[model samples]
Target: MSHRHVAAIDAGTGSGRCVIYDLTGVAVGSAQEEWTHSAVEGVPGGLDFDTRQNGALIDRVVAAAIRDAGLGATDIGAVSTTSMREGFVLYDANGEALWACPNIDGRARVQAERLTQAGISEDVFRIAGDWVSLTAPARYHWLKEFRPDILERARYMGMLSDWMATRLTRTFFTNPSVGSSSALFDLNTRQWSDHLFERCGLDRAIAPQVVEAGTLIGHVTPESASRSGLAVGTPVIAGGADTQLALLGLGRKAGQATLVGGSFWQMTVLTDYPLVDPSRAPRTLCHARPGEWMTEGIGFLSGYALRWVRDAYFEPILSAAGSDLEAFDLIEAMASAAPIGAMGVVATTGAPMQSDNWRQPPLGFIGFDGNTPEHALGNLARAVMETGAFLANSHLQKLEELTHQRYDTIQFAGGSARGALWPQIVADVTGREIEVPVEKETTALGCAMLAAVGAGMLDSIDAAFAAMASPIERHINPDPERNKLYRDIQNNWADVTMAASRMAECDLFEPIWQPPGAKFTSMTDIRKV
Candidate 1:
């Protein structure tokens, strides 16, 4: 095969990014487009995105990445796409998109209820693994029940990655990475669930034919060639969800784990078999590789929590700043000053922080006191970071039991990753040696690697990761002095968080609670120092 560079297009929750990677996996160029997701019908939480607008932006961003690479798109060996999982656009027989509702859109609550009423809902824990939430099965069922006319017109339904693959190659297909997030795919069978389709009244045919993560779907057609600057007939590969791709990019294997410290904070560890946790189900996604799954212990907050603290709790500090740079400096300085334990601080909240449980309000400072940093916000910042570590560790312990493997190190990535202090804090708080990637934006690199692997430019996913992976930026060894403090705090925090759920158990929307707390605490105390 002829040599070719890899191009990655990521249509994500917050923005769109196109990146070009050389054969060695070093990034040469990239471009990004950040768009605001306006609520449909001008109502609150009626979340939606313009698929066409995002689609056009992908086309433009790819062109920019190519231009920045000092080569035309035609120079690229292969193209692959990655995206946030579970959202889909309905397409007519002619490939026209109906309204593109994002995965978190709330318009389908009633539709979801209908599926439950139809006995379509199983134990959620047994058949499907973990928190089923608005996974693809429910999303497709929503269309069938609420928007039947559109459902009738849909010759195809697809995730953002699959849709882009279709746009580039004019063929509808899916890879295991995307399929794992869809409730339609049975974790045991590694194929679409006939039972789920029959109960939801969904046409399995509307879903694309499933393939492995590195499969080449087709070549770029002439129309896309003109718009994207990629040559006509250029190979396009079907890749994966952004998070899963990032896991692979971080060199995570079935026995290892990686953590992301971004808008959404998550820890993904490789598991030989799927774990069954009803409460943790919403956060879990099956692995793309057959008989291998990723036991993801994640939450919806982290860096975004920091952004919230800056805006709400610390808005006065931001407003008094002379400039943007000065304001950012002040925030960092505050985080630096905050002592490790945040001085008896308990819980620092942000952005509703919805789990499988109650809808907590935005930005709550629970267990506040006179000792709490009032004007001095360092305590709050430390608590926020500490909360992140504690929460992350919360999931890791469960995953270890489910996978029957222990993680020696945790890999870090994303915007918050630039802060060296956070890694040490994570290490001290979680008591794990931290590995941070030198090259940031690994999600982009992961997609490029997938494209290369799919294009047959690389032998296997492991080989692709080897070719594209970078050296570790820095290492943060856990401080034995602080580890004891963090361990006590982590135990208290976990138990307190658990105890407080009883106050919320009365709420209709909360997750069903079970006891014993999952043994995450023992792992903290038993860490090999």
Candidate 2:
């Protein structure tokens, strides 16, 4: 018997993927394409996205998925898309994009500093539930400061997924789940804050109409259908941000914390109301489900570091195998053979940083005794894994302190959770049980679930999730002995991190060096050392 299917587009930091799934949560066809942001000369952390090019690629990938599925456009019930949060595109009145900024774009650091200095940081945190990072506020600030002409001509500002939905369906709508990441969103009122727009020197009218997830934005236009091989009248679902969508895919509920182990690590807990605590500093945002909230601590550099180490160091050794799975296997084998505590080496992932503070923790190892490359590789892998664990535990503690809630189980997903050792490490370090679900592409599954809901195939998101979510595949329980060892390690790591922060605060390494014959007046001079 032929089964019904839905298409989902997942646009991530480095790549875009389209997957078609059956109603039983089984992936029937899939395709992926890697896309990169163009680099600008002499601009540190500057990246530009071209939506026209990206939209075309999205069409191609979605068409490819339909072809691979061996189904016609009429067979697919609906289409939905999810993307990385924070990155946005500015459009003119004609709906043509002027400039696009991804989440990685950091050209607005100067403006961000300006806001911090002007005491706008506290106000933003109170209203938006987050500190000023490289998101909309800073991007808008940069546009107002450097490119005022473009700012003057701007008619629409939207997150990347919202822009995609508009291109496909000719409707401009953004869900509160993605809006939660924008510094302009008001946490209390669940709407755009006029005060934030005034402070950022942007007009609130530039923002799109806010909607909830699972809402039918519009039907695919004929032009889009021709380009994407989707039905002309296919219902387009308003999917939310990638992280929250993944949580929805997991069928998450209140009282559960989810660890999305991707290139960036986020430990998020679902809540019934907005919980804003500057002391905790975890991001508080609206959940994909209406009337729910999510608080998270993110590690921006954890899994990316592991991927870098693998590609730079281990890939060559396993190049003959021509399989990433084999390389990961070797990495896991080496790490498992290494002595506990990585032979007295500690590597930090440089995450959970405070933007308001000037001092940042250094990213790397503190203790290394010139070990062999293999030993170092093993230790490096262990360090990377431990860094994720440390960050997760830190966030868990912060959430517990702020909400007075105890989280004993962490539902895990994303690319990093594929291996057995990493999950074990996380369980051991966090001292919590790790539950792994059957689906590997949780984000894609989430979009598909939303599509089903929008197409009337499912009554609601909860109903869709209950119908499609597969059973838990594996469970990792913490080892008592390893948990004790991790506690001590965490304490020591804390002490070293404090020392580093203090050193940075004092600018200890910035003193000028005195050359020979130069006058050195004090013993604290670099020449004295």
Candidate 3:
């Protein structure tokens, strides 16, 4: 029988999911499981990716998805993978897993400082379009310093998605979209940079072969087929980074801006050229589509912050609801009932993106009146949601300055876009039209598009998207009065966050988040470029 379906495996920061889609882009089946990366003992910000455990989870999700589709494994024509970027896995000569860490891992502070102090960070940023903080070079140096034994036996390094593709086909290869995030690729060349390895004192031999997304890598091995419920000889395709792939699935054309809001909120603008910010405030990564590049600014843990508020303060509401979706709906309804400024409650949950000086103030709510409904949970939640919009507006301003272009409309995707209230808030805060697609899981859909291309069901990545991608389901227009109020509120929020950051500097409070090696000696040093 002719194969007419494709599968996508996605390993995200907080979860793992498998989605099966037919040639027409319709999702036939899906399964998802939440997972966590544990912090390493004695390491301040180290988060370890348990390969053995996560691998099992991946297997279970894939098998469950195929079963949910009510189709035989042989029906899947191709498989592709995508994941949270920056996280990587190491392998020994015999292909055994050595060590792995998630994207949020920050065990290499000293190594990152060494590179920065030596003035090598500028060179890496200039070539790779990324900083040294969470990239591969610093992590490799950390291994060399603290875990030399493991490094000695390691033969290859691959990103999380690359690891998934390798497990299926037993082929070690990486694509530019994720590879560029490692600080090991030459942005212009879209390949591994030998100079970067030499400068970082890392072995060049560990670099994997660079391939473009949607390229056919190899056939799935029998062992992987048995474990994942995939057919042997199924084609495995190289996939790109999650954000970039999500852009592809959203049909983002050149000169368009998109906000991907999930565990982290990424503000990305597509450009025809690989433009590096001279100030190094934003990150640049290769797009899933060849000859394209994306300048990105990130809001740290925006979605996670919202989740914390829900779990910590709204458990009663959650218990009363039938499902998480229902709970979120109720939360949105409450937020909608609150006035625009959220009753003067300013939430400093997310900071504006600064790749070179990444940090966040302590997550908090300020200026609430306990005597009035200003202290209500609905107002607090609305303030938290508004912080995400404030951060997005900040990033969009920076991107506009860098690109010398103004975006009149923005494409919003990811988990946050599913809520009508959040999207409207974003539109009002940014004073831009917001378009949300029918499918929120654009990352997995983009990976499936690549699978379709690799399986010869589509002519190219663009063709696959044109043939299968969903159309925009809704458009949100900013209310003029609300926009004016948000503009004033955002300014006050910025001032409050800066004061909070100073409190962290004084040791009176702890930062909600900061990258490894990020240090600001004074208030002036903490300012964005």
Candidate 4:
């Protein structure tokens, strides 16, 4: 077969990226453009984005990447897309988007709670193989209750990746990996659940057609080709959700687990059968490949927490570098200098799991005295990194228990993997070897491999990945002493998080610092007013 380049577009939460890669998975060119996500004015916890605007940005990046590659439209053999899962767009009969909501939007929490009250969470989990979520189904529930008019007017609903594929291929479809995340799909049947639609008061007609990932949906239309700088008949392959695509991109097989550390942290294990112990809170979804499932556990606000530390504490470094790219160097250097255990400071990075009954735990810090110590900054940085490690380790341990197999090594991907200290911290804390790939954007690379499959350049997804697999750049081994130190700290963090969660349950915290036995009258009176 002749060698050719394929293009992959990733519509992520913060930005849209178009990357061009050859058969061997070497990036020829890449371009990314950011988009805005804002809260809806009248709807609390509603996050929305413009569908058409995002499509335009995707086209712009595709054009830019082609230019950077110095290749003509016909040089690209095929195109594929992957995107943030769970978010969807409501379309009218004419295929015009009425509204769009992102995964982070929690406007449907109340609706989801209603389902939980009705006591169908277990049945929902049985069918979907996932925890009850305030995602697609709950969004439909919200619309049915509050905006029945829009519900009646809408003809079709599809995930964000489906919409992007339609923009390029002029076909409306979604893959099982994307569909399963919507909380409206039956994992066993790999189709939209009729009972779920009935529960959410939705019409089954509104659901998009289901297709397998890497299947050829359609060729790029003339209009889209002109906009995106691609050949009119370029094959547009169906791609799965970003998380699943990342797994394929990292060349993960059934025996392995992967941790994708982005804005949110995710740990997924590839298994032949769906890992469906309702006791395990991890979400089980179909993999991009047939007859395989990914058991996924998610930690919100992981890498973002580190970004918070950067902007909050590393102002001088940010000023010197004038951008986040260079500021990370200083942060990593400082974190490297800090001793293990973050000097007894425990940074509780992720909140407790579903049973907490409270809102997200406050980002807490413990064991800090009033005065700033000499290693204060390093301690703070290391603590933040350690928290992320502990959170990942917690999920990894759970995954091992559920699957009855231990993972000696984990493939680490996402932007955060570019940082040096964080991966080692995770290795030491998790007591597992960490493998970092040469390419950081495994999600896009995964899409490119699927594109290769659709283009007939590779016989199968496995073949495509084997041909284009990137080499591992680093292998981080756990330090024995540090691992032991972190074991105690990880246990302590659980206690600390539980205590903070309990404190949050009681929202009344008096400022009086005296012991119960000491006199509190003076301090209480002074602070009461």
Candidate 5:
């Protein structure tokens, strides 16, 4: 049979998914399996990616997707892969996996602190458009300090997506979208920096060759084909980080902005040129497209926080409904009953993006009284949702200042966008129109677009997007009155969050979240920057 479809394998933070898409960008079949990274015993903030088990999971999903699509392996024309950024796998000289970790792994806190204290972090931000927090160098240093054997055996390193491609084709190559997250790439050149390797005491030889997204890397090997239910010699194309490709899938263009609200909320704005922030507050990342870049402001744990509220506080409703989708609808209705400001509830859960000095105070709610209507579960849930929007607004303003451009419309995607209330809140808070696409699995759709391009079914990425991108499902316009009120509420929330952060700094309360090796003595220290 002739090759008639393309496949995208996504290794996300929370799950592994395989989606098959036809030429029209419509998903024909998909399979997903949730997985978790295990915390390392006795290692503070350490999470290990079990490569052996996860690799099996990937194989299972790929085979299941093909079966679900009711198609033979020969029908898939090309395959591309995307994954959560900042997580990587190391390989030995013989290409055997040595060690792997996910993005949430923070075992290198001591090493990251040392780098920051030594002022090396500034140099890293200047060259790599990233900081030492959760980047590859600190992790590599940690391995060198604590697990020297793995470092000595490590001969090659690549991001999770690259590792997936390597599994199929036995070729190791990284694309800029994911490779740049390692804090080893020179933003100007979109390649590994020798200075960074030498300064961080890492072997430059371990870095893999960089490739642009959609570039054909290699063909699937017979061994992998047997295991993955893929045809031998099927073309394997280089893919990108999930967020970057998600932008492409949403049909975002240069000079546009998007808010990806998933486990984390990322406010990203694409630019034609790589623009580094002098303060290094926002992260700069390479776009999937060559010669393009993006500035990203992250809201940490926003989605996870929402999930926690549902599971912890709304369990009765969830259990009665018997499905998250239905239960969330009921929750949204209850939240709607709360006023625009969620009855003065200030939630300091998800922290706004601050790459230079990343940390968060204890997760809790302020401005609530016991058993009152204001302290109701509905209002509290709404506050958590509003906190996400508030953080996005802060990031958006910073992006506008850095890029010298105002975005009138914002594209919202990911799990949070599936709901009606959150998108409207984002539109109201940002004072911008929100466009939600019909497709929920945008990252997978974007990867499929790349696969289509790599297989020669589409002329270019732009062409693929034009041919395959989903239509806008709805356009949310900001309510002028609510937008004005949100501006004031957002300011109050910031002050409340800062106060909590100061409390965490003084050890009055433990920090709910802190980047690996981040140590802040006072909130004033960050403000002075």
Candidate 6:
């Protein structure tokens, strides 16, 4: 009650970190331990990482953050974690990860296909408010059927955060956001489903205990404290998946929506009630907002698509002259060089030009006659950004059918949202007024707020966000002129999508994957080929 503090062990695909937040929802201290994700190229490429190493990174960074905060483990009030979802760590009785699988490692598509074949997926979706995914629960299916040997030694298959929480508190529990990612939990009941358990051939225990975010899970154990450098008795809260954490950091309340525009771009509108889509692009997930859930419209390739253009095409000029810190400086300069529509050079969002089926290729060139990189660069940037916006717009229209609500303004937070020009373009393209929060790392703030609620410093997540939240600083209103032009571009992009879908139906441009044999042991084994 004296002074409240919270900590986050952010387990990312590439790194793990310990972040400290004060009562005001500001980061007081932070420390990072880098990790790597290994991949074998196919559709998603086999995105794999060393789970044990990631856990070690968590221990190292937590110690560093405690030291940086000028406090030992005992001073912190509570701790929670935000982590990459879908990857499950199989545990033995000793709480050690016998083995693990990364999320959407591009291998579970077959299992997802199998679920589709069984016709039980639709039932799972109707009840769980989750679509069958090539991750998490489907992963259990793949493992149980394919790797019976490994399953013999495995007991619990929990997300990275759940495993870490169990490691700290000596109790196994799951957060709402993480459980939703499982594709097995009934969003309405907020618990595991007998329907899904039987469908996937998974055990009921495979469903971890669901805990509401901001619940006081427990204190760190002596063993965890010894290694993590936090006090053994420091309270730990049930945090959530990183996106939900980011949503919290963004100060999501009952009504406000969040735009997470990192490598992938997702726009979410929250409601306690969720509507699920099976065949279409707009998918829904449980929101980090307590008593409420959210519907997510995601674009797989947003920032990464633009980065590809920056590298494969503009690297010689941009890289030699500009760095990532200064990337926007160069990109904006280049964007300004091009005209409004990049001389009719249309950009795409993975319709016809689906590279690895994630991102659309560079903006299709129409009138490329002696245009410099500066002139061409903006078109590519605009195209990718607009195409992404158009895709999000398509989803927004679809999700409105379920929410019976519309977002008047979008709160943009991400690396790309920092750019003044791109944000305006996003606003103009989406035709919605965009509000940029004071802090871009809303996910971090979101996680910390949940932790605060768990620590009993705040009664509710909404109250914590409302009391701590401030007004937006930068705002972008849709320009009448650019909005009109982008509308036309959006129409063109729709035409492109229709054509691509048709071709895919015709099987003219199809790709096939014959699953690798068990000979494919590690990501490394597949990578060397």
How many residue pairs of model 1 clash at the backbone? 4
- Listed per model in order, the count of residue pairs whose N, CA or C atoms clash below 3 Å is 4, 0, 0, 0, 1, 12
- By summed lDDT, the worst window of 10 consecutive residues in model 4 runs over 520-529
Instruction: At residue 264, give the lDDT of candidate 2.
Output: 78
Candidate 3, superposed: residue stretches over 4 Å from native: 320-325, 371-375, 519-529
> Superposing all C-alpha atoms, what RMSD in Å does each candidate have to the true structure?
5.1, 6.2, 1.9, 6.9, 2.2, 6.4
Instruction: State, as a TM-score between 0 and 1, how close model 2 is to the true structure.
Output: 0.91
Alpha carbon lDDT of residue 162, candidate 2?
81
- Compared with the true structure, what per-residue lDDT tens digits does model 6 show for residues 1-529? 8656788777765457787878787677889865656665543545555766777778889989988888766668888887776676777766677776555465666676667566666666676655555346566666677678777877676777777787788777787787777777778776677777877777777456788877888888898888788887888888888777777776675666677876567777777666565542455567666677776766655666777666666666656766554555766777766666666665644431111122222234344566665466677666666666776666565556556677778888866787777788778876789998777766667777877788888888778887665458798899888878877766766666555444443555542221211111111110000
TM-scores for all candidates? 0.86, 0.91, 0.96, 0.90, 0.95, 0.85
Off by over 4 Å in 2: 1-3, 320-325, 353-355, 358-363, 496-529
Q: What tens-digit string does per-residue lDDT give for candidate 1 at 185-285? A: 66776667777676666687777788888788899999989988888888898778878877767766677888876666777876677655554432455
- Write the residue-wise lDDT of candidate 2 on 1-529 in tens digits: 2338999998888787799999878889988888888876666556788787888889889999999989899999988888888888888898878888776676776777677677776778888887776568777877787789998999988788787787788787788888878878997777888999897677889988888899999999998888889988888999989888999999897788999987778888888889887662577888888888888877765677787777877898778668656777888888887766787677744544343442345556767786676698898888778877787787787777787988889988988888888889999988899999888569889889999998898888888888888678999999999998888887776666556544543666321111111111212110100
Q: What is the lDDT of candidate 2?
A: 0.78
Model 6 spans > 4 angstroms off: 13-15, 32-36, 40-45, 64-73, 278-280, 307-325, 346-370, 497-529
Q: Candidate 1: misplaced stretches above 4 Å? A: 1-4, 42-44, 117-119, 123-125, 278-284, 310-330, 343-362, 367-375, 491-529
lDDT of 3: 0.88
Best by TM-score: 3
Local error of candidate 6 at residue 288 (angstroms): 2.8
lDDT agreement of model 5 with the native: 0.88
**Per-residue lDDT of candidate 5, residues 302-355 (tens digit):** 877887887786777667778565657767888877888888888889666778
The CA lDDT at 294 in model 1 is 69
Clashing pairs in 2: none
